[model samples]
Target: MRSGPYKIIIGLALWLITPVETFAQSILRDAETEAFLHESSDPIFRAAGLTPQSVHMYLLHENSINAFVTGGQNIFIHSGLILAADDVTEFLGVMAHETCHIACGHRLRRGEAYANAGTASILSMVLGAAAILAGGTDAGMGIMMAGQSVAQGQFLAYTRGQESEADLAGAKYLETVGINGEGMIRFFDKLRDQEILAQVRQDPYVRSHPLNRVRILQLQQAVETSPSYQKPPNPALEEKFQRLKAKLMGYLYEPRRTLRKYPPSDTSIAARYARVYAYHKSLEWDLALTEAKALVESEPQNPYFYEIMGQILFENGRVRESLPVFKQAVDLGPREPLIATAYGQAMVSLEDPDLMEKAIPILEDATRQDSGNTFAWFNLAKAYAWSGRDAEASLATAERFYSAGVPMMAVMHAQRAMESFKMGTSEWLRAQDILYVSQEAAEKLEKQRRRQERQRRLSFED
Candidate 1:
């Protein structure tokens, strides 16, 4: 059975669940969704005097309304929070607030960036480490929590003072970006209503953010006084936000729920997007194809529509049929690496050596741009191996393992790669670098194992 945090599940291929004891949340990853988030959040990051590349935004497959900044430069927003937002401005507002947490350095910094590590491994740098300190479950620990354990205690909740500071800082960011602050206040006003609920019933945002009357008043003052408080909404982003929410609803919600929410009468682009995912995930391929085809007709130029159609066909044993659709998607030259990776993956899946010539360069480029994508690396390895390039295959396999946080496997593959390459060559040096990092990561994991055992013993005694 396929396992680990990086396993490619069906549907739109965004659901990557990270098992952390009893605390698990799916980390959604899609090249297109990530690109949208990066675009929307880039301004706030810039306003905070930070580069968009420095801070990464992650979407959690959580229904609770929460967005948080942790470790140093990572911001995690629950998909539920995105669905809850009334408009794009509200979504951006939450992003702006989280960026403030980073800008204000509300959490003490720890560790350095692992530039090549994949999604789950990246989270392992922060939440995974924090989960370990909390004595996280042993299940899938090797894959999900297999990186440096540098941070402690600060990811879940922030001090009231910090929350207040972030609130004030967030308003300034929206003003700096020439966006309306009404959305910020409106979003917070919704959070304020949640405080009346029982603690367990309240949203995670309320628990983590510590909303007080004074803080809300200060937030209001900071936002309302800004010159950009009444600026018009960006229509394009607003439309995209609707689609984003629709896609999340379709992917994460039950098919029945999704169809009910966006019935046949709702033939809009966003509604069709939701239905396609819902139909495909429900194993109703015909319905999915119909919806996907309609979506392509509605927006012939849109790469994402084609992407969803390709995903549906690719996942449902129609790999050959999906190729032309995926071709159209990549031909549009969408900036999303995942779409290209998916296209490359489809070609490699055919297991035809003749296709390698066409597949290899696409996979190589996708892997180079998105080295952290384990799926891309895995496909590239398979493509190389089929084409009789054992050395390249081994190197790609090493990268896949490293990206997935299985350092021992990575080290082994890296060693294999090294033996195939000449000494001091670029490939050999790359293999050597993988070996070094994997070895160091393995040692740290060994230490973590010992610490976990002690913690288990202490818990048993208690």
Candidate 2:
């Protein structure tokens, strides 16, 4: 009920948007994200004493070189760390660390502490972020809580004595997995070096995790004592992992630098990775297509490889071509919300309004799958808008935009719906009521707009 400027904007953004029914069906399904979760058949899962429910690894798009555990069921790894690793062993090392956290029940303790402290507000934020990381629906609810309640002190509690516990646990897991703890040491060393150069002083991981010289020293000692701490010869899987890492780096790095680091070679898949980025960065659509085509040909079964091709084609505005590639990806592996969302977007962009009948249910599935997928909501909003169901469309668009962190777009959609209600039929008035807007404000805005338009034309002529 507050009349402050910010409150007004929030109110409009939350409730009053025009019904753009066409934008409702564009979210990525849970099946998609579920497919992308990390799984391994290594005996270490059991050897490390990890219950199946205790260790669920997720791949997040965050570029920061960090990995964290939110609770017993969720271990979040940043994509940047995966891309930065020299081999699968190093990647596994990070997993081992997070796994240690779960095995030690640190995350579970944090949750218990927060609840017992009556810090429901801070716990709400953590739960929200955790939900998105776990690929769950209602992720936006988490974001809303995060915005209202996140505090450095509360987050610091997640780090207390937990880092050392994970380091030791990871070292032990490496032993059971027949992996050298040295790999873990190597990855931690890299992170330590990064911390010194970071202008921000606190890397996202370091801020949340209490990494220190003592922690590093302790890990080194663990590796030194661990039996046969030797680097394993890179396996076939390592090569596949490299290709995946390179492809990701290609997207993140400048083309020239990527090419220099990953020179063209017949045997090296990194070259293809570099080329994909090069062509894309250079805006050479045809060349990018050629590179992507070659990549898909060589790695036919890798869904991630297809994702690269689909991304290239999509960025180049070849929506039709992009659609099939994304579809191929979905067929290859349907659990990634990103792929499904992209596929749904392509379907909507193809100009078949009837196709939305197909897309809406898919997006609903996606939202139910993981409510944090803002892009899916965005595509759904467009679908709804074009379908002439303005009320639902506006709400969907507003919510999608809000989830995407685009407050302006959210406010615009809300305002559009409010205006439509004022100008259109009694149906518009009915819809406005549903949107939670007052008749007095709606009439005032309409009157203000009419006066402004009159002034705009007169000023233009003058």
Identify the candidate with maximal TM-score: 1
Worst 10 residues of 1 by lDDT: 131-140
Per-model lDDT:
0.75, 0.58
**Candidate 2: minimum summed lDDT over ten consecutive residues — where?**
8-17
- Provide the TM-score for each candidate, comma-separated: 0.87, 0.64
User: What value does the lDDT take at residue 88 in candidate 2?
Assistant: 76
Model 2 alpha-carbon drift over 4 Å, by segment: 1-37, 40-64, 71-80, 107-162, 191-228, 231-236, 265-267, 358-369, 384-462
For candidate 2, lDDT tens digit of each residue in 347-374?
A: 8877697877677766766655545566
lDDT per residue as tens, model 1, 1-462? 135422323436353534332335545777668878988889899999998887766677778788876545767688889999999988888888888888887863223323323333455554443432332211123334344221112225677888878888888999998888788788988899888899778887886677877887888888788888778789888888888889888888888999999998998888998888788767788898899899889889988788888988887888999999998998876566778888988899899888777899988888777666677788899999888999999999998777666778889999999999999999999999888877876776776667768878988999
Give Cα distance to truth, residue 229, candidate 1, Å.
Answer: 2.6
| Predicted structure 1: lDDT | 0.75
Which stretches of candidate 1 lie above 4 Å from their native place?
Answer: 1-23, 108-155, 196-199, 458-462
